[model samples]
Target: MLDAVVVGAGPNGLTAAVELARRGHSVAVFEARDTIGGGARTEELTLPGFRHDPCSAVHPLGAGSPAFKAMPLERHGLEWLHPELPMAHPFPDGTAAVLARSVAETAASLGPRDAATYRRLVAPFQDRWDELVGDFMALPSTALPRDPVTLARFGRLALPPATWLMRRFRDDRARALFAGLVAHVIAPLGGVGTSGVGLVFALAAHAGGWPMPRGGSQAIADALAGLLREHGGTVHTGYEVKRLDDLPPARAYVFDTSPSAVARIAGLGGFYAGYRYGAAAFKIDYALDGPVPWTAKEARTAGTVQVGSSSREIAAALDAVSRYDRAPDVPFLITAQPSLVDPGRAPAGKHVFWAYGHVPHGWTGDLTDAVERQLERFAPGFRDLVLARATAGPPELAARNANYVGGDIACGAAAGLQLLLRPRLTRSPYTTPHPAVFLCSSATPPGPGVHGMSGHNAAKEVWRHLRARP
Candidate 1:
């Protein structure tokens, strides 16, 4: 009998296992796949030497995670490489808006007209970026935030819809850039609480600058796994836990999976039927013959690039994601060019790029051509350099990881109600009716991101439950 049985070996599950093991509790992790690393996994998806992150590549959440900061991942073989620019949003014209590490520089890039507005909106929180992240990332608390006043100010701006937030900017450059950042929310741009998504990403770029693991996101997962083993946790890959009976006896079971999957795997019944899931994605990874020839100079140096023309267009496209079942024409695309900064990711002089656009939930349309068109719109002749490509639509994503149900990468939507009480409205979202069971996936609070807070947070509760037992 073990102290805990962690079902899944993703970043969340590994973090849970590590946390329990370090506290002198025996732990075991079971992964369905031959390999682990869930959304953080990297592989040769296209051609040999062209490594691609299957789901998540750029890590604003992972890099800015307080939980990851506490770990010795760096010593355990994790190196984060910072780009000159964290992100770039390109327009139809031969220009781009950049999110640099420095707020002044980022504002300046937007031009003097919108510079002050950008500074005013972002700079106020820039100096307190650490405090802001600590407050946002920590488990929900009734007590005031570390900096309540600062949080209140942030909340005023973040609580509004992203479309409303765009009103603050005078020019398309700044507005478009912000819209791109918020599009990660997977919610309609005009929907409530969308600005928070945009604000967090911008704050994160300034807090620590968006950095990717040296080799790939896999490095972060590998390091967490290594740390777990060092703490005496057992990891068994190629072993899927279907029913709770499949797992060894333990005081507690932490499930790093969707609320829907957990109910089936552990016989907990069903999640709230009213649980509203938002959009899914149509993703593509390419093995390029050469660097993407972007007309925008800033995009050449950016690690993650948001490919779209303007805020208005991005908002409309994203709106279709929530209201319709079909993918939008000229969709907003989020792209990451890893080989531009890390040579280990591709063959010499070659590059590996990944991009994805929002689609309706469980969308099965082949969006390969549509996504390629969007890419070529900004970086003309970009298709010429594509030696090979791999794509994952909704069905494909769901098949790979059960958590990414219907290709919804966020696991659960970040809407008005779901954002506050994810996976359902329970006093303890992680805790199930069964005392020994807990949901540690991104489905829990502090929502989506590679940040291990969900796992770390759940483990604290599990640890308490274990300590109470004889």
Candidate 2:
């Protein structure tokens, strides 16, 4: 028996456990896989000595996140590495768009019209970013500060479609590049609320400069696990907590698993007639001999690349995924080549690339060659550099991480109805109707990416809840 049991060792679960242990509570974490760091773990997937981050590799959100910043994983043997530049968006015609740390430099690279618009749109938040971000990141139902200016700005930024924002850009390259970045939210680019997703990630890129954890994202998770150990916390890996009754007795339990897992663990107790499902999903990883040769040289600067040609192109791809159809020709892709920045990731001159494209939920399309073909369309000879590849369709993805149920990475849909009334409209997003049982995974607010804020936030609520009882 312990004060708490966290049922996952991902960044979020570790974050929740660490927060509890720091507050002097006994906490235990259980992970299904022998390895911790769900999604953040690094492994030699391709070949000997070639380390690839199986899930998320780049960290704009992780680096800029206040949650991770406070954790100070760097103190525990983790180093956050920033490339000379953040990301490069290259086009088919040999031109590239680069997002740099310096606003002036990024703009200068874009030239006058785009440079001014980019700066103008993003610069106002510089002095007020933290204040503004706090408001935007808050759950839509949460009462915000009574600042009219902040509210107005947040509404304007969040409510608009990403395509609307792109219309402001005069340069075609600039529009395509920014649209690609925003599509990381897994939403249609031209759809409403897409701007909010784009704004947060873009702001983080310039603010934190998009970093990679040295060695791999596992470094961050290892640091959290080490910290928990130092604090008398225990983690049991290779333990899949299928039933709440099976877990060791604890005053409280927080689930870092997916929404569907929560339902399963809760069982047929009148709590889950309203579960969500993903109709389409697929994941593909490639092991390239070198970097993705971009048609435009500047596109190589970015650690993450968005692969839709334009806003319309991005929207259609997303729509296809939503409709559970294999998008024709080019699919929307979120790519991260950490080896471009971290040479230790692969053998000398041999690079490891990681990418996952949107696919029909449960669709078994092997897009390894399709992904390469799209890359080749933008970067000639891209196919020649491929050394090996691996892929996980919906079933395989669900098999790999139960939290990624139906291969829905955000744990659930990130847009529309799900975002507003996530899992249910309880007072605390972490807790459900079930007592001492909590959902701390990415399924909660401020969803997705490698940031462990949801778990940290949920841990706080659960800690208070348990402390207030008995």
Worst 10 residues of 1 by lDDT: 135-144
Which ten contiguous residues of candidate 2 have the minimum total lDDT?
137-146
lDDT (0 to 1) per candidate: 0.87, 0.76
TM-score of candidate 1 versus the correct structure, residues matched by position: 0.97
lDDT of 2 by residue, 193-278 (tens): 77777767767777878899989999989999998988999999888777989898889988888766776886736564565654
Q: Which stretches of candidate 1 lie over 4 Å from their true place?
A: 142-144
Count clashing residue pairs in model 1.
0
> Mind sharing the TM-score for model 2?
0.93
Q: Where in model 2 is the C-alpha error above 4 Å?
A: 138-152, 268-272, 279-281
